[model samples]
Target: MIVGPAQQLAYVAADVARLAAAFVRESVGAAAAASTKSTPTDVVTHTDFESERLIRHELMVRCPGSTIVGEEFDDLAGKNSVGWIVDPIDGTVNFLYDLPVVSVSIAATINGQVVAGAVADILRGEVFDATLGGGARRDGEAISASSVSELGQSLVGTGFSYESTVRARQADRLVHLLPQCRDIRCMGSAALNLCWVGCGRLDAYFEKDLKPYDYAAGALIAAEARAMVDLPERNGEQFTIAAAPAIYDQLRGLVA
Candidate 1:
């Protein structure tokens, strides 16, 4: 496996994300589910596979022998030494519905630990990136999480499951939390939601049933921006939270 500095890996991801995002942005108008996964609503658009292919090829060419786990076709992944976790299109539903809230996310890991990552907003043209022990940035500008101390004044972000039963249960969980916080926004993309938190557009964000590719890049960006984060155990179906420092405890109390 080839090993490089986390900062170097971060740049590789950011560049590839920009490339893939441009390709995906060009295909959004014709978006439709070519298939489904896990559930009928868990869609897989044609562009999803194409985007992942572009990303996988570029990453492999750039980092020879590196492992890759992508959302579109991860069943064929290689070993996880100097690995990458990628979500070629993080908001597939939004893309399929012709909404502009979509992203391309990639995270580089060294021996199972995330060390660098990047998330690019397709239509927004903003890229958020970070490396372990390095601060976060959005389009080359430094970014930070919200400083809001009161949970009632914090603007939170969340998402729902594709499963109707799980969505209903998640909705019920929000009922108790809704009144306790400023209010939640469901942007349909966990990666973008966590980036929004990193840039202070959202004070906190949490969601259940997330896979590694869904939150890997965004979580690193948020954490580098000084947000507190708690992710699910590897391959476990649990919740992930990225919250402002001052409101971390309070926000987790309500959502966790």
Candidate 2:
């Protein structure tokens, strides 16, 4: 019995997330070397490469004909229309500092639409996953966004950019947004932050200058969990906003 793309990709995402989680578990607290990416604040580790390699290999072998695009490596195109977007380590700085707030994210897109995704929080051993029209789950149990209707009562999650100037601007935005919301939390991992929104750990989440590998899986999971999601416009400045339905507009307005 052959499964559909959504089902097949969901399974693949789960497996890949599990594998990456295991790698993180074994590698954490070990003496892993790190290197800078675009800036001094943007760092990568050996675990990131190893985890991406593992995911790319498994995805190619299991799916057979799907392109794999990862944060650490060049794109691997395949024959099928499906494409896998992976973030081997979503919070590398935190991981490097042993902060236990990192995650592995995977998403499958069919002809430009995300069909399925999974995000594994390595330290918590929790996995959040979703398929298009299939809702969302954390560790196999169904989940949804919070019911916080007012922005002043909502606990929002956000992230910063690697560029120094961007970080400065993000701080400025946070200053204006801080008093409007109940409080703001900046978890190092964007993927986990989005999953947190899905599981009701956060009432809302928004960030700017995110890459496809950063929010691909997480945004899908949040939307499936009944959160309102606004992805960044294509070929323009990248920004994302996901929040509970009741507070989406208020949050977007304040942040804007």
Candidate 3:
């Protein structure tokens, strides 16, 4: 493992995520769609900008000159070796619509590797965080993935693409996956879905075409929870997966 101040980075991630989550909680009702990106269905809200701004400023202050790669803003390079990956509002549509599934996620990287991360479920006021080899925790209590070994009995979570054409392809794949698994849940927020997997609320999770910020933080938490994780690189398409060790290969066979 890369030796770094993982615990300290995790703390920083949690602080920024908490700050961003608070902003989202307060701005949800008043926030409206400022514009659409990629497609009409893919929307962005004023709250998103504000949340990311808050996260960026706080993170920079905490870890001065840290590079920030955020959803709504251009990447910032700085003198520090630390880097941050942030998603201000993981569930933009859900937030504007007053749905409680929204989340704020941030990951801290050192030497180009993710060392720590945090995902805050804003409406629930719960924060999940973890560091490399430190295990996962929700609200400071250790959490782990489910022990379920049977694919037919596992609860799976997933998300679709913003592009309808890609979604159509994803749906076709799901037609096969749903029958093989106990059930499927598409929560509209990849980060939240991944965190749920870490806490055992979800047995496994997989999604296609996710951006880095969407899965970065939550993936670390899930992996630290003893979940079998396969995080994709910045290839043209990123198909991410996290499952209990027992059913990992089984679930991946279906989704892959």
Which numbered prediction scores highest in lDDT against the true structure?
1
Better of 1 and 2 by lDDT: 1
- Model 3 steric clash pairs: none
Would you estimate the TM-scores of all the predictions? 0.95, 0.96, 0.96
Model 3 spans > 4 angstroms off? 1-4, 234-237
lDDT of 3 by residue, 1-256 (tens): 4645999999889988998898888886777899999899899998899899999889877889889999999999978789999999999999888888999999999977999999999999999999989999999999999999899999999888888888999898899999999999988889988888888999999999888899999999999999988877843347899998899999988887
Each prediction's whole-model lDDT (CA): 0.91, 0.90, 0.90
Count clashes in each candidate, considering only residues at least 3 apart in sequence or on different chains.
0, 0, 0
Q: What TM-score would candidate 2 get against the native?
A: 0.96
Score residue 74 of candidate 1 by CA lDDT: 52
Task: Estimate, for each residue in 1-256, the C-alpha lDDT of model 2 and write its tens digit.
Answer: 8777797799889988998899878988873557888987688899999999999989988889888889999998889789999999999888888898999999999997899999999999989999999999998899999998899999999998889898898898898999999999998899999989998999999898999999999999999999998888642547788899999998888774
lDDT pick, better of 2 and 3? 3
Q: Tell me model 3's lDDT, rounded to 2 decimals.
A: 0.90
lDDT of 3 at 209: 86
In candidate 1, stretches whose alpha carbon ends up further than 4 angstroms from where it belongs are: 1-4, 75-80, 234-237
Q: What digit string (tens of lDDT, one per residue) describes model 1 on residues 12-113?
A: 999999999999999978998899999988999999999999999999899878889889885345544688999999999999998889999999999989
